[model samples]
Target: MEEKILLKYIDVPDIEKIEVYQKHDGYKGLAKALKQHKPDQIIELVKASGLRGRGGAGFPAGLKWSFVPKDSGKPVFLCCNADEGEPGTFKDRLLMEKNPHQLIEGIVITAYAVNCHQAYIYIRGEFSQAMKVLEQAIEEAYEHNCLGKNILKQGFHLELSLHSGAGSYIAGEETGLLESLEGKRAEPRLKPPFPASVGLFKGPTVINNVETLSNVPHIIMRGPEWFKGFGTEKSTGTKLFCLSGHINKPGVYELPMGVPLKELINNYGGGIIGGRKLKAVIPGGSSTPVLTAEQVEEVAMDFESLQAAGSMLGSAGVIVMDETTCMVDALANLTRFYAHESCGQCTPCREGVSWMAKIARRIEEGKGLEGDLELLLDICDNISFKTLCPMGDAAIGPVVSFITKFRSEFEDHIRQGRCPIEKDKSIKVRG
Candidate 1:
């Protein structure tokens, strides 16, 4: 209900300008952090604030910062995962486009806190305008001596670079982003030798989501208690929720973590478009399972609650579907995306996702056999855990959930030789 912290400067004209951003108390966080707080003290404050990663994984920010080997003696690298490639998610783009300096300031403060000498902002290749805005803002920060060596006369030095990804969803994955940054193919590396211990050229590094790092300025400026006052106990601070599809006011809404899904849809989203009845909602991004309208009432728009409801708060991409939307067709759409996006490094993900997509297409086209549902489930089950990355499991979530929650709709397609909802229409065949 309170005014948003992340979205506070969103509506300000010329928010990219250092002057405008300074007018809104932008670099105050960095100044406070450099002049007063020790890097460890800042990390301690962030830990006390209870800020979790907004980058879909829901990892604690302070815990992640602590993962950086404090005495590695190597130049620590801080990378902001700004590849906003998740389907039904556009909040990061807005943040970058509107308040570029906020993100940069956050990155600087975070780099200082983590003892990183260099940082990179990995922007999505498709986001040319966002890149331009960020570049201009970075130049201004350097001009003000807020970025380069001896920032605020505190003797801390940091170099920042803006690298554009070659357009892949998997690149949003932390390890994959690192590979892409290294000018290699974007493929996820194994964890444990996780990014903290060995990342970005086998040095100690910290990779954070765009929105997660963007909150650092606020956390430093207002103090940990001020930020902790916003969201729930565990999920502290505000988040940008990207609401889309069938919603009257479909756009990004910055709200607290524990806000109810119903309130987000009805109040902030202005309910369903055309006043249609809400059938289902994907609380997170495309990777998460759909929540029926009834289920949305009880779920809070946070990480733990959504996970408890058999879904995740993935990037906070809330895609609302109306009654007229067909579950089978929707799942087919999402599965096809994953199938096309799969890196093909692992057999289960590469082969299984493509197979599932083909079967889902056939089922949607009404040519599916009686045993096809079981086959689809089998393929999804096979691919869920037998892959190198979460992509395989994420790709299978909607397929398995669709068949489980709306089995009758899939069955109707097989029995009736066309989608039951669109019975009069011809089924489009696809391989």
Candidate 2:
């Protein structure tokens, strides 16, 4: 219930303006870094703050920055992964739209900390309004000499570019985003030589999520101790949770890490719609496994706790479903999303996802055979960790999780030749 620290600038009038932002202690972080701290010291502070990537992977922010070889003469690039294509997630869009300068300030501070001279904000193509805000903010920053050529009178320089992807879910993946930025098809590259070692024109690069970078300015301005004061011990800092589905109040809520699921649903999300009984919850985005109401009450919304519950704090898209929602239909809907989004680069993902979607559709439609459940499990096992990227694993999470959590619903479809939850319609379908 605390006022949002990250979204503090959201309501500031003319927040995109550099002058307006600076008036509100916006560039103070870059100024502090420029005046007092060395690159390594800034990195140390970030490490101390315990900031993890909010873009899903939950990788340590400072650790990721440290991977860039400082001695490498190659130009280091800092890319803010603003291409938020994850289903049921839209927090990044709010940050970009309401407070573009906050993201810019954070990016500048992050680039300085990582000793990078150039940075890019790779926004999704569909976010036309967000793109406009960011572009205008960039131009304002340039005019104020905050973005290019000796920022804050320090010897350090930074150039920020706004690059939009052609709207692909795969583009949200780090390697795939890199490929898209290079003016090629957005397919993920192999990861022996990770992006920190060689990336973005084969130079040492650091890619961070938009939300992760947005936290930098605050960390630098308020000090690591102040920033670490909130959230759990391991997962520090507040997270922007996009609450949706059957909730009474379906909206974005910025809460600290380790917030109880019940509190988040009841207090922030206004409880379930129409006073319907809580059934299940996708703790993270669609990629995460659904948690039954009992599991939801026990699970805390954080990286470690969610992982321990056989799911992940992926993108913080909390989709709450009531008892009226059928698990079979939900799984089918999510499977279709992944199937449509697969880039067709790898056989397992391209084929396995499509196969799963087909079978799920059949099951949802009451045409499922007896062996279809076992076959679905088989497909999930093959696709879980055998592909080029996490996409395959993500594709299989819902299927495996749904069957495990709601086996009776799946069996009912196969046995009675109709979804048990929907007697009149034979199947449950809703948008």
Candidate 3:
């Protein structure tokens, strides 16, 4: 069984409450850190643990934290990117809704490490339940003196706030999120002054994913060596995989980082829905490339392994597709979403995304032009690595991957003027 750290008390009743959470060694790590360890010591412990950002990027948390300028005569900020906007990703929502205090403890310790006086939880607008839960948790923390002035009598003052985004996918980007939080339009800003040195109203800032911060308390309590024992040398820690799509059991599962993809499908997900044979899978959310059944066998659920298999472990949203699924239609559906969500800031992402969506819709609906395939790839070439933020790259990920991996399916859709399988049997269309 995978060792549960964040979800250790997953089944405990009322784990969202401070009282219940306190009974289960919840704020114990915060108490220990505030009392026993200095901010530098806590940072060192995290650096040794090898924990990466759980929110798609997989960047090392400690390295990211280390970038904050210590001597800057400004109050630093920590913003939790709780905007769970990625399709098929609800793991953060699950964490927030079930155990908001666990995340709160993490925020307190991380604030101490980075010397951030003020913090904000930038939650998604759609996650009303998660917002309510987090608000309640923050209130509870304030009530118990876990937050605000002179936290735990350590002379470390912190004020945590909750802010909700207007449901823009671009806001999920750190710079874009900063812009939104500052009461401006949500759009990606230029880098180099990066969020570390300058962010959130011209102050040094640190933004962490909800799941990433939730691990801090555990890493401190369990020690780095113990934390490193569960996963591979490089990818050390359990990962919360958002398993969905054409599966018998589809939900957020906390599994060891190196667990095989096949194991997650069979052992944890109970195989594909209706016991159908697996055709392809979006190994990590809608933004990642889809993997054919043959390619998924040798893959492990970590950053490096999936990248090696011509895909990314983005958000770890495992969207499984059975044999009866249509790749063109799936790509078209996902393209539609990207098209709708594009912030219309960069011309390439704003304009190029619409092109891909149109071309994909044309192909999926059996109205594909003769040169549509080449045109789709051309659009992808212009979009990926060209736009302001990764929204452009994310928009092209599925488009290029679908054509590359499932070329036959896409071609068949054009040739047959309909999904080939759908001609004989009914096929489910998924976004």
Per-residue lDDT of model 1, residues 171-220, tens digit only = 99899999999999899998778889899988888999989988998888
RMSD of each: 3.4, 2.4, 2.1
Local error of candidate 3 at 216, Å?
Answer: 0.3
- In order, candidate lDDTs are 0.89, 0.90, 0.89
Better of 1 and 2 by lDDT: 2
At residue 71, what lDDT does model 2 achieve?
Answer: 87
Q: How many steric clashes between backbone atoms does each model show?
A: 0, 0, 0
Residue 277 alpha-carbon offset, candidate 2, angstroms:
0.7
Candidate 3 global CA lDDT score:
0.89
Model 2 accuracy (lDDT, Cα): 0.90
Clashes of 2: 0
- Candidate 1, lDDT over the whole model: 0.89
Query: Per-residue lDDT tens digits of candidate 2, residues 309-395?
Result: 999999999998887888888899999999999989999999999999999989989999999989999999888778888999999
Candidate order by lDDT, decreasing, is 2, 3, 1
Single out the weakest 10-residue window by summed lDDT for candidate 2: 422-431
- State the RMSD for candidate 1: 3.4
